[model samples]
Every structure is written in structure tokens, then in C-alpha cells.
Target chain A: MLAVGLLGLILLSVIALFHSLLASTSKSNDMTVATAMAQQRLNELVTQQPSYRATYGQDFPTDVLGQAVYAHDSQSTSTFYSQARPELLKDDGPAFGRTYYLEVQVFWNTPDANQVAANRHQQGAQSVKAGRVVYVPGS
Target chain B: MKRGFSLLELCVSLGILSFVLLGIFGVFELGQSSFHFASLRQGLQSEARVAFYALGNDLRHSSFVTVTTVPRTVSVILPRQESRGNQTLDRDGLCTAGVENWESPGAIDIHSGFPNFDSFVVYYGTSEPEGRLIRQVVRPALVGPYPNAEFSLVNSMHDNPLANSSRVGVTRTLSKRLLSFRARRDNDSRLVVVLLRLRGMGGAKPGTGARADETFELTLKTYPENTYPRV
Candidate 1:
């Protein structure tokens, strides 16, 4: 009976180790996808004309690269940008130019949402952000 | 009569139990190492992504982009705050000269009384072994042509201490464990592509045998929008 108990304990430990490894792998994959999607959005934003971009709203309409955009959550803020240096905007010197600060945040759902929530008091979604400044040449 | 096992039976069982325990331990060690390696690789990739986005944004918005062969540098001329008083002035040469003349100018003419242009440069620093990737920004300063005060300012920023100082616009280490850093302008001279190779530091623990020296290579490209006026 003692031998059987020892064998069972060893098996349980091995199973737990494998489970953790799998979870890590899954999280890594999710992060990669999120980063790529965020980059794509930023690239799109930079390519658009300044007039068109000024009309952008808070949320992006379509899904980004097949991943559903996370709903607004308290854990993180969505994509947005403000004037990095508002004082510079008021300058009427020879260097006066239009610069817009931009940021894009992307998030995706993870497979272990339930398990993570049960173990830790948090959601299972992973998120990444890409931010940069956009410059418009004076006409 | 059979209450206890004979000595021979006891010896055989002991041998089998020891072998089983050893096998289990070996498997556990392997699993641990694999987990560590995976985690390290993920971390490296995450760092690379952050560095790329930070640099790419600046490149895409820069008004001028220069890739100097010597010292292997990527310098970007960020947009400057134009004088509100000269909003109607033709200082950019767009109004005085036609589009053709504006495009043919050998060098950008910096009109006086205009605010200086800020710049950002990325290069490898003096960090030993695998050097660190350094990003240095020079605040608006009186600069002449291509290699002017701004260029010197950027070089000085690189050589200066990493701590925040008034003279230094903004200097920071972009990433560490950089085995190599290279930058070049595309054939059209419109895009700048940066290549970086990073390796993990420190060897795995003696017994864990985990992979501690994994290397990751990342390439990033960006097109500066306003470097050249659209004909």
C-alpha cells in the first residue's frame, strides 16, 4: 500500500509540471500574436493621410488579424494619443510643424481563462501596445 | 511462515525501486530545463518587439533620415516646432522655388530664427562582451549642414554617462545582450532597416543543463514620410 501511494504522488507531480509547461507555451504564442497585431495597426495609422486620421474614434471597427479586440477593461486603456508637447504646438517659429502622438493597444483571449481566473484573481487575456509620434509636413 | 519476505526478494525489490526513482528524477529535471529555456526565449522576443516599435515610430515620422557608414549610426531628424509667426512665410523654399527646385536642393537650408531641429540616433555603445543598444536624442540646437553641431551633440550624448542630465537630451539603453547591431538605408533611400542580434547571458545551472545562451535576431524597417517632398 505504501508503494502504491508513493507511485501516485510521483505521477501527480509529473502531470503538474507538464501542465505548467503547456500553459507557458500557450501564453508565449498569445503574446506573439498580440504584438504582431499591434504593429499592424500602427503601420496602418501612419500610412493614412492626416485629414483622414484626425477623424479616428476610440475603438477600431474591424477585428485585427483574426483576433477579437478586447472590450474596454479596467486593467488597461485602449488605443489613443494626445499632443505630446502641447506647448510646442503653440509655437509660431520657423520649426512649427504638426506632430501627433499615437498609441495602439492589442489584446487576445487565452485558452486557460477559467483556470487562470480560479488560481489568480485576474483575466486570462494578454495585451501589448505600440506607440509612436506622427509628423505632418507643413504645406 | 510467510509473514516476511526472504532476503533475496527484499534485495530485488530495493533495486527496482531505486531505478524507478532515478528515472522519475531525470524526467523532472528535463522538464524544468525546458520550461526555463522557453521562458528566456519569450522574454528576449518581447524585448526585441518593444525596441523595434519605439525606433520605428520615430523613423516613420522623421523629416530627414541619414544612415552614416562610419560609426554605424541611424539618425532621424524629427519634426520641429515651426515658428507660429512665420506660418505664412515661404522659409521651407516651397513658395519661393517651384517643386522642382525644392527637390533638387543639395542640402536642406535651415533658415535663421527658426527653432532648432531635434534628432534621435541609435547605435551600439561601449558595453563589454555583447554591447548594449543605445538610443541618444539631441534636443534642438543650432546646427548647420549634415554633420553639424547636432551630429557632435549626438556623439557626445553617446559617450556621456547614462544618467539623466540637462546637457543630454534623452539617453537610454534600448536593449542589452546585443551581439550585433546594423543599419542601412534602402536603395531608394526612403526606408531604414535595422538589424539586431541578441544572445542570452549566463550559463544554465550546472545540474539543470538548461539552454542559457539562446540567440534571437530581429529585423525592423520603416519609411520616413516627409524626408522628401512629393513631386
Candidate 2:
């Protein structure tokens, strides 16, 4: 009986280690997706310029570049996030055109919604976000 | 009398030990395979990352850009921000024509009011013998043209890259193992949306049910931060 118990514990530990490895791989994949999606959104806003005012909380295309990429965890009621204020960060130059801040917050989660909710209390606290301030060519 | 276990009891214990050992070995093998798959996936991701960095650096300061979707080619015309040896030039032909208007310390830039000068760069995807590839061509300025003496080497390489692509400057290979390269652009924003997918050569990992052809994809959108409205 003692031998069985000891071997069972060892097996459980190995399984746990295996589980964590899988989690790490999944996290890495999510990170790549998040950064790329964030970059895409920033690109669209800076490039489109005029239409950016309306897409403050929009999600960029995902997967193959024009598809949705995630399911929000249940604690996060909405996948949308507000953009930071334009004047939040200052990088204006006397000669460079008036600059504005651009930000994209990517909210994604595993399909299992409740797994992380018990630990995370804040909305978007578990998400990956990327932001950049764009310089207008000339005023 | 000191007596050890009977032969039958010893055999049963050995059998149990063998089963436990087998289980342990099985777990170890699973771990080894997982590590292999993860490493291959990371390798593919890093290749995509290299392309992303190169594209971002070239696209950010572009004064003009053109994109062709079918072959996934992007052409960018950037202001000559760096000095060539001792000569600095721009649309105003500062060093060439002896002008004094540019305010930046030593560099003459388009923003200082020269709109139509500087060379362009081209990045396109192709299928080569090794694998699908993304390549770049560094074309010289069509308008003001660099000092003739300074660019003769590159000019010759560009004219005949078949014999000179490896010497650098004229052409470059960005990434390989490319499964797909797609770029979408519009006239209004002139933003280029780039979708890149690369496949790994490794076979599928056991017990994972994953396909042998491991693919990684990266998507990006970019625009010339400095391009001007058509006059």
C-alpha cells in the first residue's frame, strides 16, 4: 500500500508538470495574437486618421487578419475597452504636427470562462494591451 | 530462520514495479515530445517576428507607399534621413545645391519642404528552391538620384541582381517557409494590411492529434506616417 501511494503521488506530480507546460504554450500563443491584433488596430487608426474618432472601442481583425480572435472571460462583461485620452501622454514638438495618443487593448481568454474569474477581480486585468502615440506629418 | 519472500510473491512485486516504471517512462516521453513541438512553434514565430521588425522600420517613416496584393509586394519611398559618408541631400538638394533652409542639425528631410526626392524600397514574396520566401529590393532614388559616384556599385547590382543579390544592398531575403503572404490596401488611408503564415517542417507530436504541418500566422497593418495629401 505504501509503494502504491508513493508511486501515485509521483504520477500526479508529473501530470501537474505536464499541465503547466501546456498552459505555458497556450499563453505564448495568446500573447502573439494579442500584440499583433493591437498593432493592427493602431495601424488602422493612424492610417485612417479621420475615422478613428468612432472606433475608440473597436476590435481589430484577428486569426487570418480579418476575423474575431477571442472569447472574453465571464467576469469581463464586455470585450470592448475605452481608449486612453488623447492628451494622456505628451510628445508634442514645436515643429512636428500636433500629435495624439493611440491605444489598442486586446481582451482574450480561453473558452472556459470561469476558470480565471475566481482570481481576477478587475476587468481587462488579465488582457494584453499595446499603445502608441502617432505623429501627424505636419499641421 | 530468516526467510525472504516466496518466488510467486517476488514475481508479483517485480510486475508492479515494471508497470510503475512504464508509466513514468510514458510521461517522460510525452514531455520530450511537447518540448520538441513547442520549440518548433517558437522557431516559426521568431521568423515571422523578423519580418515584422523589418517591415515596421521601413514603413514608419515612408513619404509614399504602394502595395500590390497578388504577389504581396510593398514599395515605400522614405526621405533620406541618414547622411551618405560626407554628403547629405534632400528634395531641396541641400548639400548638392548649397541650400541652407533645413533646420535639423545636419540632415535634409522632406518634412523641411522637399516632397519628391529620395529612393524607394520594395519587399515581395517569392517561391524559391529552399521554400517560399519574402525578398526585398533596395532601389535608388528616381528623382534627385544619389551622387552618381556614390551609387554606381548598387546601380550595377540592381541592374543585374541575378549575379549580385548576395553582395547586399540591392536585394535581400527576409524570411522563408512562407505558406502565404497577403497585403490589403486602400486609397483613403493607404494603410497596408499584411498577413503572413509560415509552416514548420517537423512531424506532429504524438498523442496531441495535431497535424504534421505546423503553421504559424502573423497579421499587421501599417501606413506611411509621413505621406502627404495629393496636391
Candidate 3:
């Protein structure tokens, strides 16, 4: 009887350790994918040359494991000055420029059904964000 | 009367127990190593992302780019009005007063004889095995003779800034842990490709057999959005 009890205890401990390891590995993999997706989306936005738009639509054509999606938005402002700074005036030209603020968010489905349901209203599951600022010539 | 297990049986049980415990410990060690490797890889990826983001942002807005092979430098001419900050300062570290307020949309009339650009250069420097990616922004003391003059100034700085004390710019360290850095411009597409290789610092202890030399490489291709029209 004692031998049987000891064997059972060892089996339970091994099973618990295996379960924890699997969980950790899965979480790490999810995070890695999320971060990569966020970076990719941010790069796309930077390359597109931000337009003077208040908000951008949430559309990511690439699908990650059929579970991850990405969305982006931008804020832009154009500032114009009546008088050019004298020091900057070489040919005494007028001055103007535009600034763009961009934010990208990537969302992925979580494995836990309960957690997914709880966060469904907040955008399905887990998410990661990347933001950037860009300046462009304006008139 | 029944007696306890014989000596042979006791010896066999002890041998089996030792083997099982050893197997369990081996599995635990393997798991630990894998977790450490994953964490290290994640850190490296995050660092590379930040470095690329900074480099790409500046390169994309540049109006002219000159890539030199010998020192692996990418010099760009960025419109002064489009630069991040409102004020432009000279080598004296003092802001140029009236120039700061200039603002215009679309491309500046470079052909119309307007002084409208700043010089920015990105290069790799510092000690090997642990180098740094540095970005230097040089705001000219005087406007006009620009675009062309700016290019020459940036090239000079890239070759050797220390030789000339009058060089005006702010040096910023973009990232560290660099094992190798290279940049080249594609002749056909006019896109700039930057290669960065980094290695992990590894474990603090000298001989714990921990992973101390993992390396990662990243290749970034960027298109300059505002290159000047070549006549």
C-alpha cells in the first residue's frame, strides 16, 4: 500500500510539471507572434506615407494562424506660420509642415474560452500595440 | 514467520529509484534551458524592432540619400520644415531665430533657390563585438548652397567628424549590442538595405555553462519617400 501511494504521488508531480511547462511554452509562442505582427504592421504604416486623415480603418490582410488581426489609426495636424523665422530665411521663403501620429494594435485569440469571452467586448483576446510619429512636407 | 525483503530485492529497488530520479532531473534541466533561450530570443527581437523603427522613420522622410560603402554610412538630406522639432540650431548650439517658424506643405521649391533641408547621417561605430548604431543630425549654420553643400558636409562628417571641430550636430546612440552593421543602396530600386547583427551579453558568471553567445541578424529595406528629382 505504501509503495502504491508513493508511485501515485510521483505520477501526479510529473503530470503537474508537464502541464506548467506546456502552458509556459504556449504563452511565450503567443507573445512572440504578437510582437512580430505588431512590428510588421507598424512598418507598413511608416512606409505608406501618412496622409492628412484623422482615423484609419482597421484592416490587416495578413492572417496569423487564422487567429490574429491588426488595426491602425493616425492623427495629423498641419501648421502654417505667417512670418518665416529670419534665421531660417535664406531666400526669404514661406514655411509650412505636417506632423503625423500613428498607432497600430494587434489582437490575437487566447486559448482559454472563459478569458476570451470575458475580453470579447474589449477586442476578442490579447493585444499588443506599436506607435510612431512621422513628419512630412506640407503646403 | 514472513521476513522483510532480501538484500538483493532492496538493492534492486534502490537502483531503480536512482535511475527514475535522475531521469526526472534531466527533464527539468532541459525545460529550464529552453525557457532561458526563449526569453533571450524575445529580448533580442524587441531590441532589433526598436532600432529598425528609429532608422526607418528618418530614412523614409529624407529628400536625398548618399550611401558610402567604405565606412557603411547613409547620409540623408531632410527638409528643415519637416524635421521633428520646430527650431533649427546652428553649430553654436543656438537656435536660428526666424528659420524656426517656416512651414509649408508638399515638397519645398529646392529649384526655386530656397534653403530647405537639414543633414542627417546614420553609421555604425564603436568597439567590435559590442558596437553601436549612431545617428547624427547636422543643422547648417547658414542656408543656401544647401542640398549640395549639405551632402558634402555630411560626407565629411561621416568620414571623420573628429578631424573638424566646427561640425554642428547632435549624436544619438540608437542601439547597442551590435556585432556587425552594414548598409547599401540598391542601384535599381533606389531602396536602402541595412543589415544589423547582434549578440546576447550572455550569463554573468564565467563558467556556469549558461548560454552566453546567442546571435541574431536583421535586414531592413527602406524606401526614401522624398528623394529629389535627378536632372
Predictions: Cα RMSD each: 15.8, 12.3, 15.8
Best by DockQ: 2
Model 3: residues >4 Å from true position, as ranges? A1-139, B1-14, B65-121, B125-127, B136-172, B201-213
Tens-place lDDT per residue, model 2, B1-231, is 999899999999999989888888878877776676667767777887887777666665553433333332323221221222222111000011111223434334445544333333445444332234434343333333223233232233222235433223445555666555665555666766667666565543546644344566666677756556731
Please, what are the lDDT tens digits per residue for candidate 1 over residues A1-139? 5885787688668756665664665456445545655564565555543434335532122323332321111123222211111112232333554665566665445343222112222335455667777665544
Q: What TM-score, to 2 decimals, does candidate 2 have?
A: 0.62
| DockQ for every prediction shown | 0.04, 0.22, 0.04
Put the candidates in TM-score order, highest first.
2, 1, 3
lDDT score for residue A135 of model 2:
60
TM-score of chain A of each: 0.55, 0.58, 0.47
Tens digits of lDDT, candidate 1, B1-231: 668889999999898888777767866766666566566667666666676676667666554434442233332221121222221110000000001123434325556532233343544443344456666554334433344443442244233345423244456676675555666555543456566555564334224454235555555555566565521
Which should have the higher lDDT, number 2 or number 3?
2
DockQ of 2: 0.22
Per-residue CA lDDT of model 3 for A12-83, tens digit only, reads 676466545544533444444455545544554454433313233311222222321111000111111111
- Going through the candidates in order, what fraction of the true interface contacts does each contain? 0.04, 0.34, 0.01
Candidate 3 lDDT by residue in tens digits, B167-223: 456676656655556666665455666666555554321124443444555555666
